[model samples]
Target: MHPRIRLELAKRWSEPHREHHDTDHLAEVVRAVDLLASSGMAFDIDTVNTAAWFHDAVYDVHRADNVERSATLAQRWLGPGEGDRIAQVVMATTDHVAATGDVESAVLCDADLSILGADTERYDRYAHAIRVENLHVPDAEYRRLRSRVLARYQARSELFATAAARELWEDQARENLARELTRLGRPVAV
Candidate 1:
């Protein structure tokens, strides 16, 4: 990423509404991707790094198409081949799932969701910041909706697509989600 572009992304992430999804999250995901790579996952590092920079480049709580918008933003800043590939990986995050053989998508998605496995204090701060970001929703409604989302994530057969993430984050992620679910008055998976 160019210096100017990196600055622009920093600016975007610092937008007033962002709490948890700021540059801190961006840097954390980039670090997680590196961690995964260091664990011996082979994928195009440059493209994945670029995709990480662009993943939440266009975040908007009210918008359902931030990924598409972010992808377009990426194309404007990146070369054709890289932009196209970044768009593909970024879109894969829309459903938060990677295809069977897509190591890149798995890496990117897993890195992005690495927050789920953050240490207890960090995870609590993340949960609180997420709530602050969604203050548009009433408290009761937010709790209900957030519970459903967390439950669905907990119910997934595999929360992290990559073997590295499963080994590094799966247990902690489940425990964190279970803690949050209990707070939300949702059932935790046994």
Candidate 2:
């Protein structure tokens, strides 16, 4: 079921024309969803996986409210009840307050952050890919923008809510955030 939903999401948004919301990103999110599922977190994996696949489907490089757009799309796909919950998880992904959200949302949030714990080379590649994806933005603008985003990411200690997530990923994520912040010239004060 989730696989079919993922296919639907990929069909809608993972075209060659787009940069950020591509098949690779969808795959990564799906992997994270699976990790969360295996971590014993109580979540509707079907809904969360579907939401993860579509969370960035409508992202605009310059627009800030893609979460709302993503949530709307998920809601429409889900219809009442379950759709509402799916929408909430998608919304939680949108740079908002995920730590205080529902249990499912918290799990989803951890899944999303799992990338931060990836191997350094892989994480570096992801950053480079993001830059290429948003190539319309000038280098200086990208640097500042990336710095702000990385800083915000590092500011949170509650990066992953589930116990397994915290135990497995918290340190690595912080390390990644530190490395990224240093590269972006916003290194945390020692």
Candidate 3:
């Protein structure tokens, strides 16, 4: 991906209404893709880059159709054939809820979880950002939701798909989830 294109995507992604899917989120995913690329995953870099820019470009947390909306936006932004590929990657992200998936989708999903494996300070900041982004929900409701999300991650076979991510991040992600669960007074997954 060109630096100029990345800048344009960053500008487009910098909307005030976006809570979690802002430029920082996109940047982090891009970094994850780079890490995966360096780890010899042979990812479709351009497709991943395009998908990262638009995955949450149309997010509506309450709307189940946001994935399709974002995919449509990706298609419009990237042009026909290339657009379809990017849309596929964007659509793959919805698999967490839809659970109908593919390898690239798995990679995207894992990359999204990469924040959990970040250095402690960055992980803490990411957690705080998520809480603030979701501050619209009442405290009790947020606690329950947060617990469910962390528990889901803890239950996964591996928090990430790529070998490098798994080796470098698996323990930290598990620890992050355990800490969050403990904070919410939920039983840690043994």
Task: Select the stronger candidate by lDDT from 2 and 3.
Answer: 3
The 0-to-1 C-alpha lDDT of every candidate, in the order given, reads: 0.90, 0.75, 0.76
Each prediction's Cα RMSD?
Answer: 1.1, 2.3, 2.9
Query: What would the TM-score be for candidate 1 when compared with the true structure?
Result: 0.96
Clashing pairs in 3: none
Off by over 4 Å in 2: 1-6, 17-20, 99-101
**Pick by TM-score: which candidate is best?**
1
Q: What would the TM-scores of all predictions be?
A: 0.96, 0.87, 0.85
Positional deviation of 23 in candidate 1, in angstroms? 0.8
- Compared with the true structure, the alpha-carbon lDDT of candidate 2 equals 0.75
Q: Which lDDT tens digits does candidate 1 get at residues 1-190?
A: 7899989988998898899989899999999999999998899998888889899999889888999999898887886977888888888888789888888988999998899999999999999999998999999999999999888889998899988999999999999999999999887879
| lDDT of residue 76 for candidate 2 | 81
Q: Provide the lDDT at 77 for model 3.
A: 66
Q: Order the candidates by lDDT, highest first — what do you get? A: 1, 3, 2
In terms of lDDT, the best-performing candidate is: 1
Give one digit per residue, the lDDT tens place, for model 2 in 31-99. Answer: 877877786767778777767776787767778787898888877876798778788888887773565
